[model samples]
Target: EQGHEERKSGTLSEPQEFHSGFIRINPDHPDRVLHQDIDNIENIRSFISAARAAAFSKPVIAIKTGKTAAGALAAEIHTGGKQSSDAVYDALFQRAGMLRVSDLTELFAATQTLAMHPKLLKVEQLTILTNGGGPGVMAVDSLLQSSGKLAQLSEETRAALNKVIPQSDMTSNPVDIFGDSVPARYQQALEILLHAKEVKNLLIIHTPSALAPSEDYALIIAQTLDKLPKMARPYVITNFMGEDAAYAARRLCSNYGIPTYRTPEGAVRAFMHLVSYRRNQKHLTQTPESNADDAKINKHAAKALVNEFLAEQQSYLSTHQASQILAHYGVECIQTEVAYTPTEAKEQAIELGFPVALKLISPSIPSKSEVGGVVLNLNDAQEVEQTAFAMLLRIKNTYPDAIIEGFSLQKMAPRAGANELRIAVKTEPNFGPVILLGEAGTGLEFAQAAVALPPLNMNLAKYLIAAAHDKGVLKERVLPEKVDKYRLCALLTRISQLVIDQPDITSLELNPILASNGQFLVLDATMTLSRYQVQSHRKRLSIRPYPIELVKQVTLKNNTLATLRPIKPEDEQAHQEFDQSLSKEDRYKRFFGELPQFNHDQLAKMTQIDYDREMAFIITQDNATLGVSRVLMDPDKIHAEFAIVVRSNCQGLGLGSLLMRAAIEYCQSQSVQFIEGITLPENTGMIELARKLGFKISRDFEEGSINMVLALTPIDKHG
Candidate 1:
């Protein structure tokens, strides 16, 4: 059971549970266990749900390998076609907040580190503690290799370290305590490292030596960590050298929740997982600005275009048709007209004045540039007709099998910036529709693109657009204004939404996307649709998008019209004001204590919720937050803790009742078994509200609180 032993257990090995988990990273266990029940979907769902529930206590990682011919056969024979596509698995893991790694080494290291310090979210730098110089250098090399940073010792920290270990022999970042070290000396260094603000992670490396206090060294570190407060303790991992001298030391470290790796590389890699976790979680909560109208798409018009193309038995859209689709969704595209004859090409080219481009549009040829099917800078009608005739002859000679539909006459748009970018939505065999951002065309062959999942909001869209910034292509802005990053981000978000709305679309590409003075336009596009209906058991998307469909209007008992919708990331500022507007008494009634005001971190947590298992609905009259109803679901998916609060002025206006009904309906729809909450015993209004909402109310004398429980449905146990 390599890397299978639970880090929480003190022992080296424990009795392995056959139903331990879906450990996809384990290649040693090569045999794929085939569950016999083919149609027992409930059984599989219950099992997966339970596994996800366990993962909530810590991060869970999985790697799905073997998608080739032989591997697919093994999978099909094992599961009897019960295995949903890997895209569904990605969505499932995202909903669970599980980190999906690509290798076994990463899986074990990340799992061990997270288990040791669940609250250790991010690592800016590491305070390395070591005995020998060689081992110290090894630790530093590993950390830097994993993209880890070394904390610079402040003057005060340097002075303290000098006092603990003589400055003559000390290294800067690694803070070497010399080859012959004692437990007392290590403790002194530990005190200085822990108090230093520059360090967020700690790595201790010690090579086996007769002079080293091997057993006492681990014991001292453990005892010191036990005394420090939870928040004060940084992420700590130790490399205790050899098996002979480090056995007892390893046990002591494990017992105290310290991850002990046998090698420096392993320890540093484990710490990097903490860094990755922090970065990913922060991105998840970031709420960038976006207009409400930005998401509004012409669904009817887009659908009609797709229907027309499919009716003609065409699997792919022409450049003209693709541009039309982009226009319907408010995306700017180069003007294009399909020219049937050389005369038609001359006519459209004349209307464009000058500097037009001609592209051969064919059902069989998706990439026209590949076969010299495009010609630019046709300044006059004569050139347009001449190039159009030559283009037809060349296509016949070069690509004889390519079905030449018609030639597209497009206006040659000028550029604001010299750079050309490509944005695409291509279905991956494993991750479903992945957004690709890079330098468009043949240039992107060697230059890697930034890839992300679909259903992106503004924040994620920004992340994808800025992906090429590190490659030095984005900085060469020739225009007076810098690249309109927000506009570019909005474009990616629109494309993401388009793909989510249209599942039959297998691939969409926008090559040589031009951006000038904050304006963006697509020069060319090609899209393909699936011929047969997709028959995966999973939905089109794993990550749930913004619930615009969930928005509803309701008239209160006072005849006051109120609109309710799921909370958005942009609601952080409004939420802060809502908190301040609450009276002291009302705050105590709602939060179980006085919350004078929510800090920035508190505000972000309330605004940016992972909508898969959590949801908050707010009622507004005129864009002001009037009341909020929220639910925090248990990982089990059966139980949820729900609460609602209305503004003091809005109370007693039937707002609370409306919110309560919505919460119950939401819980029932999600298959939540029950909802429960606790409030102060003195809060009679809440007790009355609960009783009216069909909740069983009871007083807890021991805790001096009122308990309310509402059973929505029964859990379906696997039979």
Candidate 2:
């Protein structure tokens, strides 16, 4: 509990200041209780949640040791804490917005670098300024490994740099300022690079030189940064390449608020940390596109099928059964027919019109091709009958008691220039439902699969697709027409919705989902079932899904019908329009000052909220948002600060009260202790509304604001 407080408070303490947190886990130790009493998965998640609390957006680095079998054995013996798959840990860290490092060195490097420059907000290319060619090359290699870009020096910057360095080659990025160059040369080149729009990030590598101490070059760089205004200075990192000779120089740069590394690789790794941190922060608030088809989803039909399967004690659904479940959710699959015997198989293939593919169905045989249980392109009924009989005989000879349930036949998918892809859903012991996508082939492994947690919106689905493309799981091809990415993303989003809506689905796979001629068809699909006992489907997810249950229809004082529900990312435009309709005085009362239109990021931050720790209730009449009330919960989940606003024209119609009541009800349900807010003293209408809501109101003379506090649940001081 104490460790939890520290992790939560690490950034919450002084949110105005950037605080980078690091955690190192060593399962092997002399004292078992000291380093070992943790459920690796859950505790790691708790730590990540605390670090990623909406109150702060700082980089958190984690180092989990004991990844190998030998280390796992030691961990098990020492702490009785079993190890989990390292890949799962990697995916969790990535999805949860934490940076996972291999060791203390990387953890420290990332934490220190991010701590020094916490506002490094972009993923711009890096420009390396080095005294040695070898170290510069090493930096370039590490940069690419980290998925970083190397900046190309503009001709203008390069020309200016050439005048100072006097070497044509030295003017380019990784601008090799000759080893024996004077210290002022570093300052001159830095000034020119700082002005260049291309040089967003700068890495200076200074190896030991006989002509001048590394300290002099470091001093010059430090003095140059100190003289410039903080905002005018470009992002900078330094690598002083020796232990003793460079220690003082490294220390000097650190004192000037510049990050320094012992090696170029270390510096590049640190830069990537910042890059990942910024990108992850944006993803944290990414608004998923609202699916209009959500209303069309036949969740009941899918649920009834799952119930029937479970009641029949059938864990794995038959090919046809799985296809029906998918059809309920609008996932397209190649039509297939099942046959219980060789005669039936031939008849079914004939009915389907041949040029068909026949696959064996058995719980024991996961891969039909490996057991000679799959035959394709059978042109005639005779060939189909013969192939089916041969496949049954071959499987029976290999395994005497193999359960040969039957065979399934589908029209052969067109294969010329088409791409086969796989999308699957599996239940992870800790992370719950995980969605996977990859190139379809024999023996697919999770290590090679692109993973994303479920309840994905279109935006989140796009991110998953992007990750798949980056990992080479999804490829771009000109043949058979380029894959319709929009359609593919929509399919993925629907698949995710299927997983989210059906808790009984323990596993699902759409393998060899043929993508050709601008169409995506699921060639083969399998689904496994389990009893759904969890009270809420959202509980099964690491990330909370949207709260559809919170949506309610209410009539205001004037009998104006409106919907009071949680706001969605898709409401950004409507939200903006609502804000603009507010009178200046009403806006001031809400925002505490005259407000301008919000930019995309600010609006995204407002609409794309984390449902786990926050709630925003927007009251809408027809399709227009009338008012919104939102509350941001603290780390402890005890106190929440709220803000409420209503359209000026809609005022006095009870929209504010309706929205506020909805927010309070949500807080009370979440067991939040207090919901508080501050308003200008001049806003008597809001003050009266708060008072009527049973809040204890007080005036703060110093700030000239009214404080409204409502204690929904009392705290247990003794407990």
Best by lDDT: 2
**Lowest lDDT 10-residue stretch of candidate 1:** 31-40
lDDT of 1: 0.70
On the 0 to 100 scale, the lDDT of residue 312 in model 1 is 85
How displaced is residue 361 in candidate 2, in Å?
Answer: 1.0
TM-score to true structure, per model: 0.78, 0.88
- Candidate 2: pairs in clash: none
lDDT of 2 by residue, 422-444 (tens): 89888876577888888887666
Q: Please report how far candidate 2 places residue 564 from its true position, in Å.
A: 2.1
Model 2 / residue 462 / CA error / Å = 2.1
- List residue ranges in candidate 2 displaced over 4 A: 1-39, 43-49, 69-84, 167-170, 287-292, 477-480, 535-538, 556-560, 593-599, 634-640, 673-681, 691-719
Measured with C-alpha atoms, the lDDT of residue 348 in candidate 1 is: 89
